[model samples]
Target chain A: MRRNSPLVPYLFVLPLICLLAFVFGLSLIRLVEFSFKQVRGIDGPWIGLRNYELVLGQPLFWESVIHNLKLFLTIPVMVMVALVLALLLYERLPGWRIHRTILFLPYILAIPIIAVVMKEMFQFSGPVNAVLTALSLDFMVLDWIGSADVALWTVMGLIVWRETALGVILFLSRLMALDESLIEAARLDGASWRQRAWHVLIPQMRGVIEFFVVISAITMLSAVFAYVYVIGGGRGGPGTATMVIELYIFNALIRTSLPGIAAAVSVLLFAVSLLLIWALFRVRRREEA
Target chain B: MTTTARRSPTGAGMMDRRRLLQAGAGLGALTLTGGLAGRALAQTPTLDMWWWGEQELPGLQAYLDKAIAAFTEAQVTPMLQDTAVVISQFQTAAAAGEPPDLQYLWNGIYHMESVWLGYLAHLDGLMDDGLLAASNHGPLSRFDGHVWRMGWYPLPMPWYYNKDLFDKAGLNADAPPATWDELLAACEALKTAGVEPFGGGVQDGYWAEWYITHGLSQNLDSVGDAVNLFIGDLDFREPRYHQHWVKLQELRDAGFLNKDMASLGLYPGIDLCVNGQLGICSSIGTRLPADAKTTNGRIGCMVLPVFGQGALAGRPVVDMQGMGIAAGSEAKEAAASFLNFLNQPAQLASFWEATGWIPAASGFDDSVITDASVKDLWTRWGKGDPITNITNLMPGQFYEQAAIPTGQNIITAGMSGEEAGELAARVAQEWRDFNPDLVEKYQQWASELSAG
Candidate 1:
């Protein structure tokens, strides 16, 4: 047990290493296997690549790819908006704690419950429409999610509303840990507020922001299920306007029950998630440099 | 430096004590489990059951307790443990190769698919047993040419209306709506009386029920009930669905439903009706709780009003619901016995009272039907009974292809009613494309079983 012996620390972390290798590594292997092979019923009559060909050739898969791109765009906007909000809250103004607490409240709400609440508030006969009706603005009371034209945007709005709070909470804690002296020093040098934010604060918060952007993007992609299921009513309908990649994967599971096709969709989704993470990481690296 | 060195020894001692305590807890847990195994091995046989139920779940427990005790006295020592988890649990169990002995499966194309996938055991032997013959009876038990699963209740879909609201509106109580025109008139009248004419459960997939009961029933002869849905014979581009859509839009425009109905769910919408704020809605023909009855002492239930069918329109279309034993169960004997017991006439009657289900079994006492005020509401339904839902006649995959997507589209206005019908026909085509061989196999199996 020499002081510099690497084996001591390696032995201490052996259980966690085994856990990651078996769980994540084996899951990746199975996903790849299912993507390549033919999925039979309880019994096998394997016909390789046929299921993949069937899925990849469909127009809907491409449609879903476009939908996923829209979802991917939300991550940067969400992070930026949340960072701005957190910076304001961190200014230590009157009732700053109350303001921060209020903004962070929605993060504590379960996704399904939030989805339900949002649906009620936005539905045709709900308070939103009631307000429109009372003010004689009935045209504005058009189907928020029911029309093909605005369905995707409506869903994006809901996701942004539901998820921006998570970003706020993350950045708030990160901002609190940030040194105030840096901002003070920049201000003493006659730097404008924008200069201080861009040069001083953002530069220091680079790693934390990158971490947040990647995790939030991943969550945004996978967590579309709640909106798709509750608001879209499980079909991602209104002419498949709200049909995102996760929904397409769900359709393959429920509508077709073809695990091969479903797994293929999962593989596509997995690739997209990795690409998004890589892109954000590259951006953060460049910023840091 | 001397004080810090002294404190390190105390900190190390505290850490050691905590580790020892954790080890002691682990040892105690292991000892308790080892001790309990011997006692558990010697105890009475315990079988677990799972199903979704309403407030009547307590009544079911009481009934089961009595029946199981009688069985125990007759030398069957099995005890039952029950739970109510959602349907997703069944799918998970199917994937994992372990499931409860009995489960109440929503019988549809999904059940048929599960059967084909060999997720269900063939229950022919259970049906053939003398005990089952003596005890169990119901329409759902006999399907195609075989006994698939046993059921005790008849949860037929019916239209419910508030009688007090109708009386206040000065509508004739003796002549309830039998056609679309009359139903509209009644709604119009109720609206004038400052009542919401219809309690729309729009958020709870209420629009699905409306299409199935009213729209499909009006076009039943043209579509041939649920069967034509499978075969793609119904044309929404035809005037049938267009007319219904227009009627729904008219209702919405005229404020026949509550202001926020599209946002309201089933339970909340039903609560509104129960609280006397709304007048009418379509629901199952089961009894409502005491608080849910209208001012006339009962909520009125009727067959869906006729639209295009003319004089034969007032007849009720019976919607059926039943249970299926999951494809995988280790305790097949135990589950089958429970099913048989539930189907017994006395037991079935008790279940009917608890659940407000109509008798699926024949030869129940007339008092069961006659004594209830809600029964009076179902007079037309009882006499001119037409049974089936639009999706029922279709192949079991009708749920996936037609029912789910078409309903969602129509309500959302993603597609017009006519376009939805056309899309449904196309979906039916896909079902044929996918399951051609399986369909042939099922048909052949059915024919062979019928001949035998």
Candidate 2:
């Protein structure tokens, strides 16, 4: 029997298994059970696919799904911005450290504080409007976060502002770890900066890029709740335009008292997260193979 | 000794291990029991009470403590909660078959659906036992023939105006708008003078008041049955709803209300009113002084303006807030007793003196309303102010589908008053569809009612 035997792997996994069983596994079981149950006032009875039917039949659920999908598309843009900013700073430009710190500061602000600041900055009489009026750009001024057309996008902007800093720091660390020898070698053949970054640096940073993409996707999906509740001013309004999956679940649970509906929404959210995770794994596996 | 000698080796090993496990189990049980016993003995049958209060609710808390001490002498514990957390907690508790003994429930038909759905326990026996006074029961709290919740305190949702602004505008501050025509003229006068007529942001659900006032006026004819069909089998396409919606839209178009109302919230509105930038602000209660110091020395409280004709004709819509006991409380007697004690004229008066709200209790003397701040409230509510905010007095199903939805619709431009009336009618039909048994149940409850 070797000291570093196959059994050691099992021992290493025991803590994780115990944690999953007690927490996630147990909750998932209850969630499934609840999704199929009937609740009257406080009492519950078994009621097959009735809850799922109600949930899927509602127009609001479809709207939430579409909204979250739109959020998914915006994540890539945010991540790319972060990566480019990090790479620029990593070129050892003047005051790069200071730049890094400034970019990273917003990541530390509390969510509620971020929400309050965002509200103030975007309000009709806020600083942005004042600046616009001063510059004679009054045509560009409108109720930035209050309009139904732009409320969702405003929340996305705030999320990007809050999250891009962390992404920048992550990319910066990855950039620092990159081997400089390949770049120098490639430069000996008269390779330009763009050529080197595209051929050598880009290929090398692909793994880190994939990692950030997966993480950012997950963050963007969950960010819907904080956006709607904190910044969207709590009705998921201007006309339910800002409503998303999390708010849908919350509305069902609080406003409708339909646990079955809430449970179905939870399952759908889980499936969404799982699909994203699987896609990430598939990409990684394909790359490795 | 003989058995040990005869036992197999496996048996002996198992016996020893089992004894050791038993000893460990005993130790664990003793620890839990020992810890719990002390706490159980010290337990003074406390009741958790939740309510909404401002930042400086310490005065109210102290007064509550005095009242509680007088009643149970340290038998109850009142747990204060903010408004945002109350609904979520109550929802969770309702789902779990447990809730606080006494809670400050919103007096709406939507809220009463919980009682109808059996999430709440009826206080029929409690009332019969003389623990709850039949006279103090508000129409909203009365269900079928029985009462479900007690309204211990009444939150008067009224208008807060600036006296100094009115004086500058050449309008009498004492006699505020008693009719729709007067209110419009006042607003027009202030508007011409470049003063903002309505002192609130249109964004932050402030537009509800515009529709609420309209609903109040419409229900003036059926004052006793205010908000009755909010979720009933009624049509939403009524003129009453349209009148309010069209008027609000016109205000939005004309720039009489704040143009950036959608972007600004309550604090900014309050700030504007305080600085005399606004002539009149539609707000409720005697609590405005605590938030901001206005040019007129805090808020001037008056009844909400009513429109239309008949019983609600002369009176202002009295939108209010109040408290109720939980239905499934294990400590029903204690909770009932506490609510009873709290509703007594003396205790109710004390609560108002401390909390700046009026007692919902029916009979109170001039001494109870002696405080300068509360005097305005006493004078207004003296001759039984019309309980407006009819939504608060509606049945649960109707309030959610009809009242709240219609209110939201009027603001969203989703439906006009006629459409809203039609929509309300549709909603009532939907309620009957979803809960096919409710109508008969309500009828039975109505027939069972021997007392008003």
Candidate 3:
């Protein structure tokens, strides 16, 4: 058993490569194929680019893309809050370990569980409104998940609340692994705590920050289905107000039985996500340079 | 002597032979056990049936279990999925050529969609034995000159009002409103009495469609006219359809609806009606018993008030929930047998008694439904010209992209009726344009219906 043998390493990775190629690669290929053709029950005559044209022509599809972009707005807020919290914890605050565990608790909980709890709390007559009414802020007691004007923001708030935990854990690990000498040198140079954090710690943690932002943007684009589905009550309403691209794809596939259009939208979504990630990396490279 | 025996070559060979025989016997026993298990599985016929919303019906499971048990040749395995996703799952399975033996086909879009896609087997041959009544093979169950599916039950949407609330508002409980003006007066009176006139939620978008369809169906001349409107042959921008929304807006403006109507779902809205917070709630027949129970017999149902002179004046919107044999099913005979057994009068009677759903098969003794409200429902269903829900007749996309959203806009977004009607017309036109093949197919079907 020569450890450095090229054949041996290739053999070791063969199973995983085969599995990925079979499961994901083939499915993607099939999806693209289906996108080009009209799909009825199981199969239909080929109708090139018609599905894509129809999908792109839909007002609802653009509405969903806008909704996804609105959701993406929460990523910066999430990163900022998580970074502050992680930096504070890096100072060894009282009960730091317990605080860190508590902060990460929501990330470990099941999404549906969190979604259900949040949905109940945000109902028009639920505890959140009740509390507002009690506090003499009755005017502020708006329909959190019901009103078209506010529902997307309410969903964004929920995402920020649940997703901040992952951000905190990511930033915390990076902060802990930072060179202490940099911070110490800044402090010895008579820099205040804020100055040290702003100049020394943040600049060092740029890579993790970029990673978190890209990951969050991708999640916002693709993985917010359950949240929107549950909170929007599956129709992505109060009249398509909370509809995201993923839910649109789901509706096209399941509800409308338009698999061709769904596949077309899925391909578009993949393209958008890739473009976003690529843009993020390009920005990071420029900043580094 | 033991030591000498151990060293003997003949003894050693004999022991070796015995060990080999024992190992062979063990292997043979294992193989025999596995073979028997596999054979047992192969011999027992398994029929996969997909259904949804059975949990809401109290006795459906037991009835199905008994029916399945009675079929000695085949065992039915029911897959209960969320109603929202059942059609999608069926389509996926059918496309893969692995569909269940039987699938629940909701009368309007589900049945028509599956039939159009050639995913359902024509069930006309199954009815040749007269297991299902000839009367049951009418429009709801038959399409394209074939009975594509057998009906399970037929439920019609009607306005169920809390009699107690009506009485409290000083309105006649016995004589529910018969005209739009009268209904508005009742709403005003109920509002003045500190009671909400209607309990329905538009948040789910279905309540809006249900309300609009209920209104429009009454304004249509006939079921055919309604179907024509749904298929884009009749313009939705017509004043008749537009007026339905205008009247709905009037209801909203006058504060006759539940305060949180836009935020509540169907069950919650019905709960408000049942708990006596509102005077009226519109729902299908299946929810009536529960309404009656909650109101302690204070609940009564009526056809929606007529807004104008239309063809379907006294008709209620009746829709069917039925089962169809999958086109790809290998056990078609078994599936048809189960459907026939379920359609028998005795079974229908049992189902009606337990669930209060009107049996699809005709000639079932009506005496089984002894509840007064249920009896009233049955009578109404019989007397009314049976028009299908407009939501059911339209393309599924129309309901999602146009009807629901337009209704919501009218109710919540202050969208004018004219605007809503125009939007709806656009959606219908787009659907027809986008799916030219389906539109052509529906036109052919409609022509055949007229010829028949």
- Using TM-score as the measure, which candidate wins? 3
**Per-residue accuracy of model 3 over A102-178 as CA lDDT, tens digit each:** 99998999888998898878888789999999999998998887787888888889899889999999999999999
Give residue A212's error in model 3 in angstroms: 0.8
- Candidate 3 is graded, for docking, as acceptable
**Candidate 2's DockQ:** 0.18
Among these predictions, the greatest lDDT belongs to 3
Between candidates 2 and 3, name the one with more favorable TM-score: 3
**Predictions' DockQ, in order:** 0.16, 0.18, 0.48
Candidate 1 is graded, for docking, as incorrect
Candidate 1: deviation at residue B140, Å?
Answer: 6.4
lDDT of 2: 0.64
Worst 10 residues of 2 chain B by lDDT: B443-452
lDDT of 2 at B356: 55
Fnat: each model in turn? 0.17, 0.24, 0.46
lDDT of each: 0.61, 0.64, 0.80
The candidates, ranked best first by lDDT, are 3, 2, 1
Q: Give residue B427's error in model 1 in angstroms.
A: 2.6
